[model samples]
Target: MMKIAVIGTGYVGLSTGVCLAEIGHHVTCIDIDINKINLLQLGNSPIYEPGMEQLLTKNIENGKLLFSTTHKEGLQGVEVIILAVGTPQGENGAADLTILQQAAKDIADYLHNNPIIVIKSTVPVGTNDSIKEMLEDHCKKEILIVSNPEFLRQGSAIYDTMNPDRIIIGSYKKEASEKIQKMYSPLNAPVLITSVRSAEMIKYASNAFLANKISYINFIANLCEQVGANVDEVSMGIGKDKRIGNAFLQAGIGYGGSCFPKDVKALLHTSLQFGLNASLLEETIAINDSQQELLVVKALQRFGSLNEKKVALLGLAFKPETDDMREAPSIKIAKQLTKMGAEVAAYDPAAIDNAKKILGDIISYTQSIKDAIKNADAIFIVTEWKEIKNIELSSVLKEAKLPIIFDGRNCLNKTKIMECDSIEYYSIGRPAIIKK
Candidate 1:
């Protein structure tokens, strides 16, 4: 088993460290936040990810995983260092490499020998090369920098990590790449050995393509609504073509997460830096931006105006099974409705605390969907939670003041919702239903 040190105990770091340990590797997760490290050391997960807490607790109990606040402690005698820190979007939409650079410097400062450094965070092109230079300047021995970008989704991070579709390792040294490959040999996934730049570009390109697919479907969903065609039917009909899969084809309030938004902007920034105009990415972002407003506009059309209207929001997190609210469309929708003088009441299974920080006193927080819809004029489905999708329309309409449902994620059943008296239903890429 490889001895690994994972810097930064955020989602990627914590998950990677624990999951690696579960696979029989010795892992040390380092974070500067003492409270976070303390919590993690006690087998407590700071983030709400499915199966993460159990895995962390199990690994810790088995002594396969450990947490520390000091990078020096974590990096000592570590054969492999995986940089999984945050690379948040900077002012100009480029990836701010501050955290990555600091991690590299720390690795350089504490290097006892030549260890293979792997970047598991999503970084822009050429970052691996810069990291190599930084490490070489600080270390007296040779250091191999490998680009091993992660492709794990938020909700299913552990499963995705263990059973990845492909593992791309970009490194100048074939031996370093092989060692990293052997570390993941149990995964049995296809390993792609390529140049560092290509591996870096792969992450951005993959996210951008997925974002584009969602935007394209949203565009088509809008057209379907206007032309009286059902988006669900269109999606299924088109998705059956084998080449076009049905993954991101669902019509919703656009795409939102840590990956899609930042990656798209960073790719655009990279293209501009390289003197290439990325019109496709620009349009992709444009469509996603408009989607949230489109939902708000539809609400306005139904209510004539949002002034004093109490709208109940079903979900706050970007997606179900994750507490990550970074760039969530729910926040944008809440702000837009509040700006228009609407009273918003929101509820989510796990993201309420985080949402409370961003939304402040602008939106009312409720403990349950029933509480959120109580005496509300309209109900807006923001995040597509399983509970939200299966909500009883009769119960919600009974409690609602106006009995209107605006589904941003198309969660409600059209026929069932239309059966209720004085109830109206609106959804993306579908005809609106006004009770006769």
Candidate 2:
């Protein structure tokens, strides 16, 4: 029954606020955007997360959750303030703490008494200590700074939050850590208490390592294609080992989203600041950059020349089930196709509107995947949606002009695609299928 104020209503903020309320805590979500606030006040979600809107609506009806644009109004009697603001990557690849700093200053100016301030944003190793100093200098009150970095994946944020594997709390004060841990005690998840700096490092270290895993498998997949080995088989064979485990090993159009790319870059920047170099991370980024170009090359090789060619892209979001396209490889591939004088028609189950904002006039929008692929010279499966994966290649090829498939996500049955006349199929880390 602790009162919590979650500042900033972006994906992390909104999800955290509503979920907390659902767990029986009285929650207030504060945001600067009046339009977003207005929408939330009506029990509507500005972002598309599975089950978030419904939970938010239920909580609002039950008087457990509220939304506002004013921080003072939300913070008046709140016991804990969670900073969930954006920490976008800056010019030098470090996390830009502009939003976080502003939120801290605002919280300082509005607080009537000392309240525990927890930073849930992914920040550098020592950011919590600095936040404490900044708040104390401004407010002249004892503000407990705790680092409780979020580990929610975009598409499965709700499930991940409710059933987290572990929760890490970083604080100098043992009592502050205990208080936060008590709030989450009902979940029955294991809680790790550690130094503030170690907790911050855990977030970046986890993301950077995942990014490396993806890049590692992608590189192996590329070599498999050249050596006539199946990447799927290779991935399975290696992933069976318990030590390696089987996640983030899928060969696709590279990793993209709000977290992995930015965090990896920020970690590299941190290393550079200490006069150290991260050669592995540097290569991971290089391999990912080259992997996208390889897909384009495979498509062009099959089609001869892309000039005046019509191409259909099946998925536009970075990954499936979320509308975030922060660093989607689809944009790069689509733009490359357009630059080669190919007319690109794209469709996604969600994220078309957001994609249109970034890639306006460069690609045509289609109502459905079938419509997008109609009369197209080539088709690229960029995102691995379950619906897209389940599509019958026999039916889709009948509608396509050239029947050429470049599977960035390896979402097609190679044998079935090759069975069709005039069909050519190419996929990552696998043998290309060319029909005579």
The superposed Cα distance between candidate 1 and the true structure at residue 254, in angstroms, equals 0.5
List the candidate 1 regions with Cα displacement exceeding 4 Å.
Answer: 418-422
* Model 1 global lDDT (CA atoms, 0 to 1): 0.90
Best-matching candidate per lDDT = 1
Q: Compute the lDDT of residue 19 as modeled in candidate 2.
A: 84
User: Model 2: residues >4 Å from true position, as ranges?
Assistant: 414-422
lDDT of 2 by residue, 1-436 (tens): 8999999999889888988898999999998999999999998888888998889889999999999888778998888899999999999889999999999888888777667899999999889989999888887777788999999999888888888989999999988999999888878999999999999999999999999999999999989988999999999999999999889888977998999989999999999889897898899888888776776788777768899998999999999999888889988998899999999999899999999989998999998888999999888999988888877777676788887788899887666676677677789988877775
* Per-residue lDDT of model 1, residues 1-436, tens digit only: 9899999888788888988898999999998899999999888899998899899989999999999988778888898999999999999999999999988887678777677899999999999998888777777557888999988889998888888899999999999999999988877899999999999999999999999999999999999988999999999998988999989899988988899999999999999998997999999999999997777999877768999999998999999999888999999999999999999999999999999888888899999999999999989999888999989988876798988888999987766776777777888998778884
Deviation in angstroms for 204 in model 2?
0.3
Enumerate clash totals for all models, in the order shown.
Answer: 0, 0
Every model's TM-score: 0.98, 0.97
lDDT at 23, model 1:
90
Task: Give candidate 1's error at residue 171 in angstroms.
Answer: 0.7
